[model samples]
Target: MIWYSHVNEDSLPEIVCSTGYNSVIAVAGSGERLIALLDNANLEQLFVVDTNMSAIELLKLKLVALSELDVEDYLRFIGAEEMSSRERMRCFIKLQNKLESSTIIYWSKNHHFIKKGILYIGQYEQFLSKARPLLKWFLGPSFMKVFNNDYNSFSKFRWKIVKSVFSKKVSYLLLGNKDPAFIGKGVDTSLITNGFQELIDKKEFHKSFMAHLVFLGSLKQMDIEFLPASQNRKILKKIQAKLKNREIKIQFINNDALSFLEDNTSTTFNFNVFLSMSDILSFHKTDYVIKCIKALKVSNKCKCAFVFRSYLRNHIDTDIIKKITALGYKIKDVSNMESTKMYKVHLVEKL
Candidate 1:
């Protein structure tokens, strides 16, 4: 399994909300983040790329659900609420005809996740399920209070409680070690620990949605925007409107990021923008980053946006920026961006 089943990236959608792009190449995690981007923009072509077949299958299931089900039913289906197993099965059956054979076979092989609901299958979601109870037990009722309150006013006692719960010992037991051979391969523990500590130290907990998710399991109590709501109806309405007049293409490719970029060098796929949620730089080396940037056949106005975890801002960001600049791209000032204070947002444009 991949290091992350789903990475909650609220900032990507916000960053590209107004930019009109004809084509987009995005990393597919839980598929929710990409869907959020799609909800805000209408593109001529969308390529959802990922190395994990399971991740691709998950994205396909989501696409089918969005196409077939209404917003409410789609929410219910993914949320696993107000629907029985049989009803869910019926929903899947209805969608199967509308999906490709490959998708159908993949879903059939992982029918358990389908019957149980797709949202519950990710490694991150499963980890949260186990950690939530522990968090509640350790923090007690005060957890909800602190989570809901203002971060600036978060008492010292609250910080102490958070620090105690997120200690090295607890993190090791909860998140496990950073061994690539493990099930959750190639994760940077500092991305979680040091990142959280930085947020708390800076008193930016209120702005750190990822931290909230790691500690509290949900952002509902955070009293701020976290993940966007499932905009199924909105997307479906747009799709229907488009189908009545023209054709729209959305493709999903199951390949590693480096290989996908490398193989696309000869294609005329004029991707106007690329959005990644810090996975490539965090997991892979600088050489792979250079290859990805080199392989992309982007337009002159193309902008590449990446959200890097705070811990990676020093070395990784410097190396990537140097390579991208060497390739003739100019770095755009990302200081004005909001909702991404927890991360170092990098935006570069092809010169």
Candidate 2:
């Protein structure tokens, strides 16, 4: 199952600015972030790293779609434009020729998702769709209006009721802590309630596609326009031009990230690198991941920027930041600038 349908981090600016002429290595989460990076950054190569075969296949399909289809067809085909299932299937059939044999086989079995639109195919997304009605009831009628204008206030009684439905006990009951379909996919038990609370408390909820998905279960027209990967016209044009000129190469590696890094450290030391470690550190032992990162072979001739995210609270301890700093790097917390407001983003650059 696709764990994410789009990017939750708002680090595109960091990724793009720091990635000029350098090689990038990013976790291929949802493939949307990778698409955006490809469009905006002048990278010589992009190493798409992920252990999940399904995620790799999804990115492969996306690459072919971006290369083969025009802007409009590409949007509609990916479910960003609300096309009919038959139309999307037809688009997929047209693009299937450019796909690898494994991708073709994967899509052949999962054509049902194509019919519905690939945007919301994630198991977490489906769960959100099923929960939308209940969420609407709890959010009351004014919540949807936030997308149109501003966040409307809820009465204390309404707030209490909403909180009850999303209480820790109830949430754990509904979304088990161990299920790969839920928490394992990074859908924290408090995500929905916290998202709603954030919307109620913050005025910028309208700017976030993630907030729309958490609250509305589907993308509104505004949300569609705000999607950096699919909606940015200039970026799309840049991507098409790069693809046509064969100026950039995308490599997909299916392996544990640490192992891949260890194996490739010899070759990577020659090039300036920007690594996007998308929330993987949130799941693994912090010391283990940090140890792997510290083991990377780099030299004074090249620079490296390593960005990682933590979704459930600020997962990075003070000692961890010190550890990263002790490795001859400077750290910046870009969480406030993050559009999702759901992750604590730490951008560490070797000086």
Candidate 3:
């Protein structure tokens, strides 16, 4: 499996917000961003494609949870908060019968992942788990305080500290030097190295926060985008309502993006928007991406949006734009208005 079981997107919902598209094609990383988009917009159909079986199963589990469990139970189950193995088994059993036999059989062998909670299995989550302690040791308890309270005034000084902590040397040692066998497929080490460097340069360390933080000497608390404990219940409730009403149809296909596009010969489904979350540009070849674009049956006003990590914007954006343009699309750079400045967004419209 390339991506374990975690959500990798932060700005997809913000990009897709209020675009009332009838259909959407998205990558199912953690499925959180896709669900967020669903909650934010009314869609008739959603096609989520991923190459990893584990990721596909994880999405299925989340859908079952949303469809069956209430907000509190869903939160507890995913958050892994005080939920025992027996409790997890009970929840899984309930979810299992609700899912297809293939899904149940696939998950039954991976009960260990279920016990720990699928949300916590992502490679990005694992990285954050290891990096958080190191960050705390280096920045101390007041680290987030400087950003939240007086970031503008102290940004320069704090940036220096960030640079020292996340320098190129450290990033290369930790991410770039990983064993190829241990590293999942389609994971580019160079991109990871560049991503860390970009974060330091942008002084956007808050993007990586995996939990809520109670800053020192302040009653105010901040929630991270990756896993906001407070928002889980509301998002789940919205998804459940949509599911119950039969307002949305979400299909998960366990195949690479290019293969998924090529395999589907049916011209019945035409998507108005394609949300590419940097995986295609970062991992797959440009030729394959062009093929995928050619295979997709999009509307005349179809807009294909791509979100790239800061580091990749300079390296890959031009090539991607050129390729998409060659296939008869006009390019629009919407990165300036994006709330999460950590990523660069580009929209390609049919000419």
| Steric clashes per prediction | 0, 0, 0
| TM-scores of all predicted structures | 0.78, 0.89, 0.76
Error of 3 at 100 (Å): 2.0
Can you write out model 3's per-residue Cα lDDT over 122-194, one digit (the tens) per residue? 6655655666566656656555554453334434555466555454344534743342312434433344334
lDDT of 1 at 170: 40
Q: Which residue pairs show backbone clashes in model 2?
A: none
Model 2, span 1-351: residue lDDT tens? 687765445656454545563688888878877777775455888888998889999888877887888877777887777799998889899988889999999999998988877777876666567666787877677766777765555455766676666645446447433333234433454654665567557776777777667676655456445765555666777887787677888888998778788886775477888888777765665675476667677767888887777765336778888888787788888766666656767777888
Candidate 1: residue pairs that collide? none
Please report, as a residue range, the 10-residue window in candidate 1 with the lowest summed lDDT: 306-315
Best candidate, lDDT-wise?
2
Off by over 4 Å in 1: 2-7, 13-18, 40-42, 80-82, 150-161, 164-212, 215-247, 268-278, 299-315, 333-342
Candidate 1 lDDT over 1-351, as tens digits, reads: 533434455545333632566566777777776665554444666777887777777777776786678756775676534567677888889888888898899888876777766766676667667766776676566544545544544355755666665544446455643323122334334444555666556666655567656666544444424444443355546654443344557788888866777787787454556545444454565466566667777555445543332223232456667878899876554534534343445565566
lDDT score, candidate 3, position 93: 90
Ten-residue region with minimum lDDT total, candidate 3 = 211-220
Q: Model 1: how far is 121 from its true place, Å?
A: 1.2
Which of 1 and 3 is the better model by lDDT?
A: 1
Query: Candidate 2: global Cα-lDDT?
Result: 0.71
Residue 216 CA displacement from its true place in model 3, Å: 13
Q: Give the Cα error of residue 206 in candidate 3, in Å.
A: 6.1
RMSD of 3: 5.2
